[model samples]
Target: MIDSKQKGMIFNVQKFSVHDGAGIRTLVFLKGCPLRCRWCSNPESQLFKPERAYNPNRCLTAEVCGRCAKACNEGGVTLIDGLICFDRSKCTDCGSCVNACPTGSQTVYGYEMTVGEIIKKVEEDDVFYSRSGGGLTLSGGEALAQPEFSLALLREAKRHRLATAIETCGVYPTEVLAEACKYLDELIFDIKHLDDEKHKKFTGGSNEQILKNIQYVFENFPSLPVTVRTPVIPGFNDTEEEIMAIRRFVPLRDNVQYEVLTYHRLGSPKYGYLGRPYLLGDVKADDDFMRQIRAKLREYQG
Candidate 1:
């Protein structure tokens, strides 16, 4: 029996998202990822452990409120020139400051929630789902990283009679992915690069298995609708040759489809929150470049 209290770590549950699937969907952002793509927008989701994040703008300042420093177990929280300085190295991620803060300046990312808790949140948009063919999506630092929790969650989503989808990095073991696929209605897999060497340089993992898994998944579930998405990063996979290789390799002739995701700076701030430097500084996927790529890929249908 699936444990009613089986828990998973998640950072956010975005509702009414139209981009993830066939209709509006509730996107559950799971925490922890295996890949370290430098251009990754959600840098906060990469770590498996729940972490503390402080926003100086939201802080009430140490002069007015010295509560966070008092709550620190490792003395990780300190005041410097009336400003709060969080020493992450000394910290253990116990969430003491996060709980003690008054102005919401101190915060923690990722928390454990059971399948029942998550389903309750997903059910909130059921009215919208029924009216617009919307449902739920499991996304993450790689949803399959938490295999058992994800399977249980997706199983419950199916029980609720909701359309389900998964956004994966395609790096997990094939059996783990294959089992999750049984519960997913649509698979949105990302192919970062076609070349294994460049793939390792960018994402810290070779695309050898990612490429093989793509074929394995398609062959195993031929009827399942698949969308292969590629995030076009500048100075990485931006060339016409690279993009074209991806477009051609991902078969759109059948149930499979291809998408060229334009890069953005949205996740850069999250890097600062974690006291890490943004790797892809000032990088963006130009609209014209993406437009041409989209047009070229669409020629396949004709």
Candidate 2:
């Protein structure tokens, strides 16, 4: 058996995904990330370790029965003022609470899988990949968070001559980027905000490292295609100035491409699942707004 040290924690392995890369692809969703973006669609992906999510709607209160609290040895489950209170501080995230819950209210986020296991799954879609000009794309929390496992997975894919891609936030160490660039045919890097303060305020990290890595990828990966994506959020980086700031800095001319993704509030309900308040409240970006942003970007598109 392969040692556990080489395994990666995966949240999901989605098949036939079109938006992740070119054509039909199998996208492996790795768990854990370095950034804590307030508007992150997958709130479950931020933590490096396994964490439990509680759904109040599905939870049959301790009043219904004390199954979860009884199953938890760490005293992590509690009834606080007639509501189910999961004390994450005391929790070991052993999945006991999830398993004991009769209503399926609790769910755990991460798991370990070897590189060989992931490659086997990727090969299941080999025919689709061949037919549609697509293969495997490693998506994250930030694939580089699990650098060795991500690289191993990509290396195995390359052995089979499959096309490989990575979607990153571009904040990883330069050495890691250098190694990954060797295997990756394409990279979709996220550029949240050009202004360091605003970027830090929302994503809880500065854009300094991200921008540096982006420039490094653009310059070094001359033969590979790179796309810089920005999640356009209202009241934060929704204006022409914010958009242009990132555009002019990145210098997307040839293989480097610029893309503006419309922000969706679909993950709002996810905050409730994770027992946290949604930061953006009811704020949302409309289609017309996205059209304007796209049009504005087209004005500068090469």
Q: What global local distance difference test value does model 1 have? A: 0.87
Error of 2 at 84 (Å): 5.9
Q: How does each model score on TM-score?
A: 0.94, 0.88
Judged by lDDT, which candidate is best? Answer: 1
Q: How would you encode candidate 1's per-residue C-alpha lDDT over 120-146 as one tens digit per residue?
A: 999988999999888999998888889
Q: lDDT per residue, candidate 2, 1-302, as tens digits?
A: 23323689988899999987888999998988889888889888888777688887887787887688788888788777877778878888788889898887888877888988888889998999889999999998988988888888888889879899999987789889889889987888999898899998988898899988887877877878888889898888988888888888877568788888888888778788777888877887877878987888888783
Summing lDDT over every window of 10 consecutive residues in candidate 1, give the lowest-scoring window: 1-10
Any residue pairs clashing in model 2, and if so which?
none
Error of model 1, residue 69, in angstroms: 2.9
lDDT of 2 at 119: 85
